[model samples]
Target: MGRGYRRVHLEPAGAQHICANRPGARPSFGQTGVESSAMSRIRLAASLVGLLLGAACVPPPGDALEERIAEDPTLLRIVDRGELRVGIPTEALGIGADPATPGREASLTTDVAGWIADALGVEPSFRFGTTAEILESIHGGDLDLAFPLMPMTEGAVRSTKRSYTAPYYVAHQRLLLAPDTTGIDDVGKVCLFGDARTQVPVENISPGLEGIRSNDGQGCARMAASGVVDAISAPDLLLYELEASLPGSRLLEPSYNTEGYGAVVQYGETGLAGFVDAVIARAIDDGRWNEAFEARIASLTELAAEPPDLTAEEAGALFPRGLPLE
Candidate 1:
């Protein structure tokens, strides 16, 4: 019943149809087979037109999403298909792991994804790739949802026309400084992993700050270790990983900006977004959220407080200029 919601009706292929003849009447004995077939097509076309004309009157929402999954086409499709297609970045530390890994445990992102699919009574399916690759899949409609771990910043919604749910997890953007570095000002060139989550906010941290690009954390680590760059900017969990791998590099105090990780869906998918938010809110209340976080990410970084839920408008105001979705 909400604005922006649409309900589509489709006729099943090869389905039986009523004849164009008079009600309860069969084709005349003198009618040819070709004449009958042409009449049937004409009737079908009229039926299609009626369906289109009535499309504006979407069915009201049931007691909840369970009673009428058809209220949201994306959710309905996921349920009908029996799977929730989720995307996670392969390179993001503590986000998710390859499901194919032997004896691999579910990561925080995967656990949250499972909660979502479970609520919908569908299987959670994951695809792993770089953030860009994942975004491409989302924009290309190859993915139903994505956990790119992108910050819910001001420009997030406008970045690619994709919708982001409230943050299920949050962290601050930190700097990994070279040996003997005092602070951000002490560092010359900063190595950005070329992620909009980091680069967009980190670039404006200091006036006239110069940023160099690396394809991944390993490259950034090597560059920092070899003195190629004075600092590497990223989230706390990633900075922790880089600090351990790159000796003499220290994670500086006082983060530059905060980052919130939210699930992404196609634009106008408010139905799916609301469902995702409910799943996360339930997880937070039932302790599943903390359990997953402790099991997967606690060892790497500690949170000052529980992550907050944000509206798209609030997210943009809190942390502006998020990643540009292509």
Candidate 2:
């Protein structure tokens, strides 16, 4: 095991680590001086203080185990089942599911799931769910894949009992300042949306200041437009949508914090995640991903009366018959 992975127990700064379990234990080391104890304590302190920040350097437990799991039956069960069960976001207008008005069979996430199912030569069965419900499905093993990318936070990955693929998309928080304002550094108060989800990130940008909470960006936009608040910490997309409403407000460049979006699979299921990533990578390389964005998302703003249909031509470009894996 790497030194970082060694288990640590908290002890006093100067107290002798009188370990009876040490393989190198000797009578002189403990009796004459505390050299062993001093060394032990130093390692412990470094581990403890570095626990949070240092953890990123430590590799995940699944890395090595995943290589061996290919021989494990659990890894091969998906192919045997003949069905790919997925949980999808039914309400995200452009990216997730199509709006009820058009009755189209596809959206970005759903179509992607369908594409995977088709590639696997299995029937695709979908369950509609909210974010919380979908996460629960992943944790409980009720889903093979969950649509609508989950953020790759520690809590998100651990709680869902799953690992994420490389980021397929990244949405971030941005600060919008009134046009009259000189600079972001000089701004004092910031209006924010959502209490639990956005509170920490808002605090991160403006340390030592508490922001007023609103239900959504529209609420914050009103405050910022009227000059009731100096700035708003909101999504760049939302700011763009509200641009006409707040004519004089200027959106700052480079989003402050990002919400990395990746697909969620059952814990230790790196093989499946890898396959999905390969499909996505091909989509990006061949222009399918960009096509999906334009056909679904970009069309949403035009206020179209009906939804557009999706084509498998782009997705099929990756794997028309089945995966290359035997």
Best by lDDT: 1
The sequence of per-residue lDDT tens digits that candidate 1 reaches over residues 1-326 is 01111121111111111122221121121221233344443443333233323433121233143432435556656654556788766555556555445423356677777767655545567776656777778888878888775566667756556888888776667778876566767887888873454445555777766888787778888887778888888777566556756666777767766667787998778889888887677567556677666666655543443545666666666654433443
Listed per model in order, the count of residue pairs whose N, CA or C atoms clash below 3 Å is: 2, 0
For candidate 2, what is the total of clashing residue pairs?
Answer: 0
Q: Residues 69-137, candidate 2: write the lDDT tens digits.
A: 234343335434545677666444554542333643456676566545433434456666665677678
lDDT of 2: 0.50
Error at 295, model 1, angstroms? 1.1
lDDT score at residue 48, model 2, on the 0-100 scale: 25
Instruction: Please give the lDDT score at residue 131 for candidate 2.
Output: 58
lDDT, candidate 2, at 134: 74
Q: 292 in model 1: Cα distance from truth in Å?
A: 1.6
TM-score of each: 0.66, 0.53
